[model samples]
Target chain A: MTAPSQSPIYDRVALIGLGLIASSMGHAMKKWGLARSVAGHARTAETRAAALELGFCDEVFETAAEAAKGADLVVLAVPVGNMGALAEEIAPVLKPGATVTDVGSVKQAVIEAVAPHIPNGVNFIPGHPLAGTEHSGPRSGFATLFANRWVLLIPGEAAPDAVAKLRAYWEAMGAFVEEMDAAHHDLVLAVTSHTPHLIAYTMVGVADHLRRVTESEVIKYSAAGFRDFTRIAASDPTMWRDVFLTNREATLDILGRFTEELFMLQRAIRMGDGDMLHDYFTRTRAIRRGIIEAGQDTAAPDFGRSVTGAGE
Target chain B: MTAPSQSPIYDRVALIGLGLIASSMGHAMKKWGLARSVAGHARTAETRAAALELGFCDEVFETAAEAAKGADLVVLAVPVGNMGALAEEIAPVLKPGATVTDVGSVKQAVIEAVAPHIPNGVNFIPGHPLAGTEHSGPRSGFATLFANRWVLLIPGEAAPDAVAKLRAYWEAMGAFVEEMDAAHHDLVLAVTSHTPHLIAYTMVGVADHLRRVTESEVIKYSAAGFRDFTRIAASDPTMWRDVFLTNREATLDILGRFTEELFMLQRAIRMGDGDMLHDYFTRTRAIRRGIIEAGQDTAAPDFGRSVTGAGE
Candidate 1:
């Protein structure tokens, strides 16, 4: 399995919606020779043209149905809200015995929307890659986007062989693959991704609403801390909107907990409880150390922002 | 004023609390010949030894009073809560014409705490350099830490010549200097720094409290979004604790607004209001663009984290 000459995992793979994740998958698959042919589709002619020009895929189609034709694997990589319609469009053209999966952030919603459209003998495995940049479009992707990142698979009742093949494919692409149930995957992601994004978005909004501080001042002085929130909030708005809508319960639950914790900290600040604030801050520091130890992020200061000269 | 051979801004400089900011000041002063001699003192012997060994100061003193002796400029780089005590310690030994300033995050508290200790002829200017990293201590200091970052000066009743000299010193060190009243500086920082750090700390705490997700799992999947929070939360706990405690009213006020905005977003999510989320996310994206345009941060994806091999 580790040999360079290993056969391609799929004879043909189709990526529907040539955005960041899809384009990144195309690059990773091509770099590792994980698929014999990679095909892509997007709603706009410009995106399809850009994908072909960027060599993200061997062929580009204007419609999802056309892209799925003759492919052994089909990846739905659009926003979560569009997953159901795209699944329905490609259901008729999906090849027998083909395996279909998605790279949506919310697993339960994707499973609920796309599972019903899977044809008999076709595998429907829902997956979410726990990685992304605060960028979008075909040009934003690179082969290393998935390197050392987690790609969670929610196979439900998919055949064992099909699940194994998909796991091997993700492994080849440099992602660590694990199987998880849909609901658990959604909840975990809420705590890790969705709620954080929402908080970042809300903070940026709050900063903008403060009339006393000019926007120029906010931008000029952002290096202190607010710049990180801007980076997270800059992520593709459409993708995040769909994530919140589809993962409503889990995201809300996590957000509720976050507000409660924030309120406690606020009370401590109001009461001038320095000891409590110090203890809370110290405890949070350990979590950051754990992330660094796990190799998920670097120990480099400022997320290595200074190296780019943009930080200066 | 821009000539390279201009006389040193101060004949002798004393830095109280030889941590990241003071050590960086020492390095910057040496790099640009901004000061004739640099002396430092820290509460911990280990820190003072490290500062001397790292060549961060020309001399290390046993006490704040000893360090301030014969110094033309004395900078209080200690935690906000320690400013008053250190000021009292160094007041008797301060040179008659010395200019005393601080690099505390909260300006009003520093002014209030240290103002009474200033000698008859000494200038007291409370300043806050809006620059830092998650890492702390003498080892984390670097000359370029303040490059292109803001250093806000709350001069209050300080002489104009004194403020100009300090501004020139910081400009030589590559920081842009801006003057603001102490109260306004505290409020602005609360919006841009203190509250953001608090929110990040709270988010990380919430993730840690989630019993359903193991800490290992949270760490493993942190790249999704939570990793940024971890970085912000990892900032020096003592410094942050002091910031919240010292700037209680402004920090709590900002936190109140943040909670209100967060609640609105949370309600939208709970109600499955995708339109509200999409609009809010869109508005936040504009603020990010503003930050990038102002050169406060980079447009590079992931804060340029991907440039380092750790991102892969």
Candidate 2:
């Protein structure tokens, strides 16, 4: 924490739909003094009140239009389902030449939904900060939430300066920013985020049903591998729902591939072909190594800890 | 570190394989003073030397038959693939009244593979100590590895005394004992362990391939939900292979169900069905809470840290 120095990422930034991502941005902005002032809006009055109470913004507005009035940067932090509606609502009130972005999980659908509603003078950069936790709402944010996380911005090769500014804003917010095509972004996230989440939800559902039948306190014995699924399954419901609803095709495509492979492994298991399972498991370990080497994740030692220890 | 006591769990305990579970059991047995002596065998002489050098056992032998000689309790700690062979190898030298058990991930397979191979006078009770870390080898275990972890025993109604003795042995090794039929044990573990590990392997494979095609450091951005898969994927390959092969039917059954639910969620995402995704995500959170409450797992407050901040 240094003495706050003025940053030029944005002036009078307006956040529409103050949830996890938006509140996080506010925290980052306040921590770095990136924005001249921060104003936010939410559909529910309680959310707006909570945002202000949590000191996530300079002021809270009742409407997206009010929040966007004269702000140089307008961030739509609503769910994918509400992106188009919020874009339409703020179109009239957006300040001239203001750079508008979002933090939605789904990319292409958001582009199609939000692009049509942006005013011609305003820069529309469909964006997603690939940083969040299971917690949601305005109060569940902290300064380091976006630290070392990705913030993917899809500009469709339309505005490099606008994209650069947005990227810089994310960088200042402690996020690693990448410029990806909206369709590719959707496809990548489908495998990385969407399908994994759905699979987790399904597994937990199965476990729940098992609890009913076995009466064995199966959940009590969930330490081995099931706990990981439970954590993913515990993500923000509304945000995930919107992501799946908006990014259906990509998710289904990857999920189909996953099931095909899973079926092959299942067949091998059933046939007692230990070779297949062994080969697959061995190959998977290489990927884990690659991920760690590529700096995509922590080594096994620092996995759950911020500090390092031996592998065992 | 306490004075020696007369009532050791066994006069001499022979471990047929010195892998992660076995090594950990040795540590636990020493901590509890539950064994007069701990000795083990490895397939390779080099591994036996390494285990002995690492002080994992009082004596390390190169052959199962040699290890079982004069030992009152013989524990098969080999992979399910090697269980039958090891049982046959050790049967000739096993003491007349020795109790034989195992720490295989799959119970039914071990029972079918090893029970008939045991000598006529030796009592066999198939067991699984549901505790481990991703690391393997003799040096990667600790005395507390089985603490608070479940140890499933399948006695086949053979002898109450044998079951009681085995349960007491595991209890002395710091595990809570649970008894069930062999097939039921396989089914429960298929849901709780095997299927989860398979899914993790599949996902890591998907992410790795995706990374190669993208030519970007995908795993660096993996903190979102990918690291869990990596940890699970990094599990001992041969052991997991044996588990999948042995627990094939149940694993496939669960995989089919998981695939069905995954497809449903994928469809909902494609259809822009936010309601469906929200409902599924919310439901899964409850399962996570159930696990935490049951003390089967810790809450994901700090990315799966134990509540007490204690070592596993």
Number of the top-ranking candidate, with lDDT as the measure: 1
Interface RMSD, candidates in the order listed: 5.4, 5.1
TM-scores for chain A over all candidates: 0.91, 0.91
Ten consecutive residues with minimal summed lDDT in candidate 1 chain A? A303-312
Span of ten consecutive residues with least summed lDDT in model 2 chain A:
A303-312
* Candidate 2 chain B lowest-lDDT run of ten: B303-312
RMSD to native for every prediction?
A: 4.1, 4.3
Best by TM-score: 1
Model 1, range A182-241, lDDT digits (tens) per residue? 899988889888888888899999999999998877876776777778888888889988
Specify the CAPRI tier of model 2: acceptable
Model 2, DockQ value? 0.48
Which ranges in model 1 have alpha carbons more than 4 Å from their true place?
A1-7, A296-312, B1-7, B296-312
B-chain TM-score for every candidate: 0.91, 0.90
